[model samples]
Target: LHSYTKYNTWDTILSWINSIASSNPSLVSKQVIGNTFEGRPMTLLKLGKSSGTTKPSIFLDCGIHAREWISPAFCQWFVKEALETYGSDSQMTSLLDQMDVYVLPVINIDGYEYSHTTNRMWRKTRSKLSGSSCLGADPNRNFDAGWCTVGASSNPCSETFCGSTPESEIEVKHVADFIRKNKSSIKAYLTIHSYSQLLLFPYSYSYNLAADHSELMSVAQGASAALTSLYGTRYTSGPGASTIYLAAGGSDDWAYDLGVKYSYTFELRDTGYHGFLLPESQIKPTCEETMLAVKYIAAHVVFSQ
Candidate 1:
C-alpha cells in the first residue's frame, strides 16, 4: 500500500485521502485547517485508534518545498501503510492504540502544482507580495525560529527568503497553528524533505548545540541505522547546521522551540546527482526504507514516554 509516482497533483492527493476516509470510516478522519495561497485545501489526516484523549500524538508532514516531490510521496505512503497494517501488525497496532498520528501530505500544494505545470524546480509558495514581482516565499524559512537572521535571505527573489514575517506563508501558518493546538500532546515532530540522505535535528539557526543534544543524536543515530539495515543506504545524523547547510527558520527548529521532545527533519532519497529531479522509479524503495526509520523513531518515542 505505497504510492511514489502519482499524487503529485493537489486533486490526486486529496482524492486519495478522500478515498481512504471512505473506505475506512472508523480509522480515518480528515481535517481542513485552512487553504493554501492558491486556494488549495490544507488538509491533515488523523490516524490510529479512536479512543479518547489520553494517547500521545505525533506530527508528520512533507512537501514544504514544491520541487521536492519525493517528500510528499513518502508521506502518502506512510499514511497508507499505517492504516492498512494497523490491525494485523503488532507494532503498528500497539502504537496506534496508545498514540495518534497526524500527517499533512503536500503542505505546499500551490507551489507543488505550479512546479508540475510551469517550473520543474520551483521551491517556494505562490503568494504575491506588494511592490514585489516574486511569486512565493520559502515555507521552510517562514517559521519563527531565528527567522531571517542567518542562512536565510531577506530578498524576496532568493530561494531561501524568510518571507515578510514569521509564519507569513499560509501553509506555514496553518501548520504552526495545528502544531500549537496540539503542542501538549505531540511528542515528536517530523518534516520530510529531499536531495540529501540526512536525519537532522535542531538548532539549524546556529552552530550551538541543543539542550537535549545527546538524546537528539541518539534517536537520529537509531533511525539512521534502521534505514541502513533495510537497503544499505547510508544516512548521516547530526544537527542541521553541521550535517548540511545551516538554514534558519526551519520547521524542525520551530518544533523544538515549541517543546516537542523529539523534532527531526528527514532528507530522503538520492544525493544531489539528480537534485530535486528524482526519478519516479526510486520512489517505492525510498518510501519503504524511510518507513523503517520512521517506525523506529515512533517506537522509541513511545517507549521513552
Candidate 2:
C-alpha cells in the first residue's frame, strides 16, 4: 500500500514516514516544521549523513496541489533512493555526505485527504473561508511574491485563488518561515508539480529575468538534458511567466527572491494527457528519470558553490 508505484493516502504516507525515519535513524530523521490546516503535522524529512556541525542543504517539497499525487510519490521515491543508494552510488553518497536534502512529502495534507475521499480534482487547502461558501486557496499562489497578481485569482471559489494575503494559508506560512530561517545554509529550492514537462526558474510574477538568469538557464538546460537521457522524457526549461504562463506568488520565485539562487520548479511527466490523474504504472519510470534531472541540479549546486 505504501510502495512508490502507487499513490498512498495520508494515513499510509504518515505510517511510511514513521517507518523510514525509525529504521534509518542515521540517514534520515523527521522534523515537524508545522501542522497543516486540519492539524495534520507537516513532517519534513531531513536526509544527510549526520555531522556534528551544520551543513548547506537543498529544500525540496511536493504535493502543493492536492490532486497532483505523482508529486508526493516522487518525494517518497527520492528518500528511498537516497537511503538505499548511499555508499554504493557515488553521486548520491557525495550528495548526502556533503549536504543535506530537506524533503516535505506532502505540504497540503488536509486538501490531499479531501482529494482522496471527496473530490478527485480538488486543488487547494481545506481551510474554510471567513464569509464565503468556498474553502481553500491555491497554496502555490499563496506566497508573498507578487501575490494575487496576473495569473492568480482573487475570487474565493476560483481554483487559482490567491489567499486574502500572502502566506494566508498556514501551510504556506510554515514552509516560508522554515526557508526564511535557513536561507543562509539553503543553496537551492525545488518545488514539484505535475501535468507539464517543464523546469522553470524565478520571476514568475513578472517578465524580468533574475540576476543569475544565465547561470540558472544553463543549469536548467543541463538538468533537462539529463532527464531526457533516461526514458527519453523531454522537458522544456525557462522562466515561468515566459515559458508557461504569468503565474505569480509561486514558491520557486519567492525562494529565489529570498536569496536561494538555485530555485526551480519541476513540472513532471506527460504534458497533460493524463493530467492530474497520472497512472501508477508510470510512477517508476517517472521517478527514475526525474531523479536524473534532480541529481544534475543538485550536483551543480554542490560543485559550483
Candidate 3:
C-alpha cells in the first residue's frame, strides 16, 4: 500500500519519489534540479506519458517553508494519484496526455529535516549568512516578487525573514532559475503551504490587479467549488494580498510575475485547529480534496490553453 497515510521524513519522502519514478518508467522521470544548503539533492519528478514531443507544463512545489509538512505531503499524494489514476481516470489521463507536471517534493529539505529532528516549527532554509547567528532564511519570503517589503521581515531571527537578497536562498534560486529556463512552456505554477484553507493567485506582492485578474478569480472559484464538492471542505480563493495577509516574496507571486499566467498558492487544510502540527490522520482527506482543486486548476490550464 502507498505509505502517505503518515507524515514522512525527508529521507522517506526522497525514497518514495525514487521508488515511484523507477516503478512507473513509462509515465514518470526524475530530475535533480539542484542541491540544498545541507547538500541534499533537490528532486523534481516529472509525470507524463511520452508522446515524442514537448508539451506545455505546470510547475508545482511544496515545503518551501519547511515546517508546513502537509504541503510537501500533498505533492507526494498528487504524484501518487497521478500515477495510479492515469490510465483509469479520464481527467488525469487527459491532463497528463496534454501537459507535464514538474514536482519538487520538498524545497526546504534541510529545514524540513531540522523541523522533524530539532525544532518542530522551523520555517526557514538551513543557511548561515554573514553577521547573523540565526540560521535559515524564510525561503518563501526570499523570492524576488515583492522581496523583503511588506509582511516579510528583514531581521534574520524573525520567522518570516526575507533573505539578504532576492534569490538568496539556494533552494529558491534553483527553483526560480529552473522556472525561468522553462518559462516558455510552463503554463501554470502552484506552490503549496498550510493552515489557511485558501487558494490564492498572483499579485500577492501588491493589491494592484494582475493582468488576468478576473480570469484567475474565475478559475479559482471553480477550483474551490470542486474542492468543496469533495468532503464539503470550504476554501476561499482569491488574490493573495486581499484574501490572505500580505506576505510578499511568495513563490506564487514570483512565478506569476515571471509570466506563468496560472500561478497559485494552495494553503491547505484547517483554520489552525492543528496548526503546523496537523495530525497524520487528516492527510488522506486533505490530499483528496486538494487533488480535486489541483485537477480543477490543471484542467483550466489544459483546455483553456
Candidate 4:
C-alpha cells in the first residue's frame, strides 16, 4: 500500500485512487475527466458528504509540472486528511458538509511517470508534436489566458513552451472542459505547485489586477497566515505576475477569466534549497501545514457562497 506521506508512482496512485474512493463511498467518488496523451485515465476525486445535489465546490489540481512531486503528494494528503478528520476536525467537517472539493491528484500523468522512471526533472507533458521533435508542452502554459505572451516560450523544445495553442494538450483541454461545465458551481480554483512557498492569485499575463484583487489578496493573506501559524513556515501572498515571475496561460488565470473568482496557485514548500526534490521526510510537515491554508480557503469558499 502506498503511504500518503510519500510520493507514489502512477500505478500506485491509480490504485490508491480506486481503493480510497471505494472504501469511502459516501464521502468520496472518482470521475475520469479525460485521458492523457499516453491514454492514461486522468481521474478526479470528489470529496464531500452526499448532498443529493451539486453544491458549491472548489476545484484543486496538482502535478501540473511533472517534476513537482510534492504537488501530487499534497493532493493525496489533502484527501486523506479531509477523510480522516471530517467529523473530528470541525473546519473539515463543515467544509465537507457544505461544499465539495474536487481534486485532480496528478494532472500530467505521462510526464510524472517519466520523471520518476527516466529523468527526475522532466517538467512538461509527454505529447508528441506533429512537426517538431519536442515531446511536450508546459501544461501550465497551455491554457487560454494570455497564452505564450510573457514568461513562456514559443519554441517547442523550450521547457516553458506554451502549447501550439491554448488547450492544445489533451490534458489541459480535459481540465478546461470540466471546469467550464461546472463553472457555475465551482466557487474556487486552487492549483498546487512547489518550491516557492508562495500563494498567488491571477493576472499573470499582465500587470493588471484581477477584478476581485483586494478580496483575493485578503483570502490569500489569511490562508498564508493560517499556513504559517502551524509551523512558522512563511509564504508570500500577492498577484502572480508581481509576486513571482509572469507566467501566461496558467490555470489560475484561465479559471479566474472564466469567472471563478477565488482562483489561486500555491507554490508550496522550501524556498529553493530543495526545489523540486523536496524530501519525503518533510512530506508530513509540509502537508500538515498546507492543510491549514487549504482548509482556510475552503472554509472561506463554503461561507462566502
Q: After superposing candidate 3 on the true structure, give the runs of residues whose Cα lies further than 4 Å from its correct spot.
A: none
Cα lDDT of model 3 by residue, 89-145, tens digit: 999999999999999989999999999999998889999989999998998888998
Per-model C-alpha lDDT, please? Answer: 0.89, 0.94, 0.91, 0.94
Clashes of each: 0, 0, 0, 0
Candidate 1 vs candidate 4: the TM-score winner is 4
Instruction: Judge candidate 4 against the unseen true structure and give its global Cα lDDT, from 0 to 1.
Output: 0.94
- Regions of candidate 1 where Cα sits further than 4 Å from its true position: 1-4
Candidate 4 regions off by >4 Å? none
Off by over 4 Å in 2: none
lDDT of 3 at 173: 95
lDDT of 2 by residue, 1-305 (tens): 78889999999999999999999999999999999988999999999999988889999999999999999999999999999999999999999999999999999999899999999999999888899999999999999899887899999999999998999999999999999999899999999999799999987999999999999999999999999998888899999989999988899999998999999999998888998999999999999999999999999999976
Return whichever of 2 and 3 wins on TM-score: 2
Cα deviation of 37, candidate 1, in Å = 1.1
Better of 1 and 3 by TM-score: 3
